[model samples]
Target: MTSERFDAVIVGAGFAGIGAAIQFKRMGIDDFVILDREDDLGGTWYVNHYPGLAVDVPTTTYSYFFEPNPNWSRLFATGDEIKQYCDDVADKYDVRRHIRFGVTVEGARWDDDAKLWRVGLADGTTLSARYLVTATGFLSQPRMPEIPGITEFAGRVIHTTAWDDSYDPGGERIAVIGTGATAVQLIPELAKTAGELTVYQRTPIWVAPKLDVRISERTKRVFARMPWTQRIIRAITDNIYETMINVGVVHYRVPFFRRLNISAMDLCKINQFIQVRDKDLRRRLTPDYDIGCKRPTFSNSYFRTFTKPHVHLQSDGIDHVTADGIVNTDGTKTVIDTLVLATGFDLWEANFPAIEVIGRDGRNLGKWWRENRFQAYQGVSMPSFPNYLSLASPYAFLGLNFFNTMEYQMRLMDRLFGELRHRGATTFEVTEQANTAYLDRMTELLGDSLWTLGNCASSRSYYFNPHGEPSLLRPMSTQDAITEASTFPLSDYSFV
Candidate 1:
């Protein structure tokens, strides 16, 4: 079979891929294809259909900067709404025409002499591209914990990512494992209907009130008529988030931010106390580690869910599973008819394993990262992986909101592609020296960030690599990221 060829091959049809496609189209380069494993375009939104599924961030903050939506029904949009928004974006930009749905990319290898990327598909087909962009998102994969006797359990096992619509928890004893963001949102919804709900918590999380309100149609019209109004709201929202980041995330180790962290912690304490009147339950829910150690949660009813008569919280470690129930480490067995695993995704492993990338001299990207810690120059390009760009790599995940991260990545890519066209360069790759220097500076700056100094090592956070170092979030202000991506010299990469 003749292998298909294109100027670029983008893996994923999420926000990053769509954004990249739009930017490339606007720049008059359309010889590319977007391949997604799903039948539809929305990546995470398409897969996760659990009850109470919604965006953790504000709707305005979570959206694309250029294509602002004035018709968000609520401050925090639901997963279905977000999926619709992504579909609308794909429709508006005519991106659907270039997408190959239900296509699985197994691996890709860089061809040295040809100076092109040979992408492998699951069907044993090959596609050649001058450049490869991996926009496979951070939260795409779901992980289930290794519980003994899991298969022997006759009850239905459900994961948050793979929620069964036909399975009803009403009047059934349900055991939900995990206390992260997904669990926080799901527990409240389950408590309302479940006859007996038991939540097994491995670690407690710092949860703040979700002050979400429905946006009035009149307000939406005002935004649509006068787009500047929406922009102003976005600016104010961004400033508020930045201030919180300064105190809780970016500068938590600094003396000034210590006071802010204390104040924030107090607010969380008050929220929990007010919602959970039972002292025992409240104490079980309160986190021992510092705020921002793990991914923080936001919910209006998560704490209040514990006050329900049927809701139960167990902080004891789980030993194993039996045919009828789960046994706590203390030998207490709780019989339940259904089991739900909210265990989060394996961050680095899932992100890298989704696609096997073989670089120059048969260098496997996964093995390289394991041998030498996960490091990428500017969070986009690697030293050996020439013409292969990654959207959400180490030090590239801006924790404030993912839209900002996508925008910056797409912006940098636009510039790089422009330079390639102007200079007629055959290939481009970050130099080993530049990659090392960039990582060194990032390490120095992260020395004062919360991920490094603020009790995160013991939180069971997915932010850290296997070596126990936080390698996920970029530890700088949003503006700093914008400036660096905008003004950085393109000469850092060797183009030929």
Candidate 2:
């Protein structure tokens, strides 16, 4: 094994890591390496190859502000296209040289006296650095349901994240478990080929119409020529999304404005009712929970896929899995040839389970989060983890577009790093008091949002922790978050 040293180390090379590396290079900072366990980049996009997987958000706004793609073939790019876009960005920015593919960071320990972090790789090689940044996204780990006899199934089984490219599901009976975002996308594609498709849903999901189309050549040419035209479109998209958040969360909770929530629910019913002809199927597909309770989905084909004659939707809870098929609570079994698990990732816990981060006072990062609850100041820095940062931090999820939120976070990081450099500080850590104060404010603010006051628990969303705390979203707008990240005093942290 080989050991190397650097000024900093970045983990995971998807949107967050790639953005971080590009920003660092722009700042004239080198001596850093981006390490990804996969041989390729595009963290989630690289791993998830499920058919019909497309960006839920518009492609115009789903990109980096620094590097805009004027030639997006579709309004919402597919999984392969997005992955290729990430690759193109990396190539254009010359970030590949600094990327160490197929290297997994197993663990990291902070050396207090030496003021360095020793990050251990899976192969027993150690790389030391002054700062450690975890860009490992939330959706890295795919989860499977804990049903009895799941392993005893005789047919081929695969998680959507680990889709087998060579195997074809055409003319075969298939069972898809879980009806989350990934399921919604892959189901429609699988329906076209599978002789029979059984969708097992524990809870209903609210789905909106996906307004997607191929980008016109004229529009692409205009964007490539003017450039400002694309920014205008992006701004309009952002405003529309912000309005949804304001109306749904900020204003909907008011006594006089509760009608907005009702209207949203009515719209959901109408959308589902129009797509599904059967009343019973519509009711089963209709979510009892209020809108915004779960992360709402958007798809043009998902709800319509149910109208297919060969498709079956089962709402009953699974009793167990048999060698032939799955048994329902009512003692009915449905035979299948292939089983697809669409259950989401273990997100409440940090994404990197293998990497045990030992921070100040021998505090393990995962252990601290589990014991004390997950709280990070500005979704970047924690109290004990000095010089360590996480991009997918709790309370950091802001705005309709994830890329926009991440851009704001990277800007804050730039400022923080600038401060560290100016002061010649070896380490920077947020204070416990600051961390608690921010979390308290977030918790109090969320009391008025739908995710907290609405019926999110019944939604079975991963947004909430085991303690029933809605730890996913911030109640404030994206602009508010950007302002906080920008103007918040750096004095809240100690420079050592």
Candidate 3:
């Protein structure tokens, strides 16, 4: 309905997008606008309003490059609070007016000759830009289990992703499925109110206590006085994150090291003692796999919620959903008044939504991914697509806060942009051979990582590849990634 043009257009206004916008502004680059699918900012935060929805990572590290929040209240803020934080960030940076909300990008591709990207919106609108950043985020897609008769359920049903205030599960028999981070948080909140809560867990999850507390007034005053001190603290604590990556992937190569880490996890079962009063229930809460195998859950209240008298646990596969309730493989039918699905988002190769993106030589994304299995050189640029960058690219997961990673990525892209502009290049694209070389090296490095062992029998995690290996997440140390990111050679790309 409206036609406008800009030097660049960014997608999503969440952590990655906000950081990108802020960095772009600081770089003295103008003529850029951020577009979000929601009516407001906060990509995942705006959509997912499930009770007890909170950030698992520490609050100190989860912020921007230019500014930090003066009032973060809690160590790990809830979804609402985080959403408000994002809103506050946009407002603080004065990028809120530049943001175009309630629009979803349907298609985006390189225009080789024109040297601009033609991006189509959900409402049949189009805009062309010199640069395009797909900050659509990793957790945007929600995956509900494909069980028969899912639609025939008679009672109210809701996914944790789309939780709203109107829906009421209070004092009702409710089914909470999946025990990941979101489920871990929501289950505790639900146990306090729901008269009956039956959890259907397919696989066990490893959980750690959220060494979390409110931001102390004294500490806030210190940070407020000297903010660089906060950044210094973040730098020192960053090794903890890098160390976890080592424990996640490297410990598998050494059985003795793996044993030590597992023993350490076993020793941290003080949380189980505090949560589950019953021995059997406590055992059910504990995981059999190595710790940090799955995305390590941080919660002070998760296991404790199961100790409630009304809560029950069912650790079997669901057979099908009947009109009245769910039937498990063990022939147990859960007669529930309401069903709450915590099943994670669709997280596989097939889950990437259909989008029309024709790059050089009319190379489409679907075919590229289908043939090459969703490969990206450093998860930023692909073989055919030119002058495009994906935020939270593949293997971009940092064990700690990823905002810093996103900021680093934005910096890398700025460098690439600098090179492209100064060289008088029309378009820059990566060579196929370089892409293959990078992926080959990455796969070989992940052979002995925990993903290999952690993805073994009884594991149905999304990180595992088709060969049951955990190559999706890079096994290399974060130092290598940062080094590679900082020194991204132009030799990998071609200029038109």
lDDT leader: 1
Give model 1's clash tally: 0
**Predictions in order: lDDT:** 0.87, 0.85, 0.74
Alpha-carbon TM-score of each model against the true structure:
0.98, 0.97, 0.92
Best TM-score among the predictions, by candidate number: 1
Superposed Cα deviation of residue 145, candidate 1 (Å): 0.4
**Model 1: lDDT of residue 139:** 87
- Residues 354-466, candidate 1: write the lDDT tens digits: 68999999999888888988888778889889999988688888875899888788778778878887898879999998899998988888888887877665588888888
Candidate no. 2 TM-score: 0.97
For candidate 2, what is the lDDT? Answer: 0.85
* Model 3 misplacement above 4 A: 268-270, 277-279, 349-354, 453-455, 465-471
Candidate 3 lDDT over 1-496, as tens digits, reads: 3367777788877777887787678666678988887887887888888888788776666776566765677778777778888888888888888788888778886777888888899888888887777777777878878888888999888998888688666798999878877888888888888989999887777777678778788888888888887878666656676666676456578877677676657654776776667887777767776676667677777777776779888886788887779998988798988888898876554333224567778888756665666566876777877877766455555555677567557667777777777887867788998889887866766667776655445656666645455544656665666678779887898886
Clashing pairs in 3: 275-304
Clashes in model 2: which pairs?
none
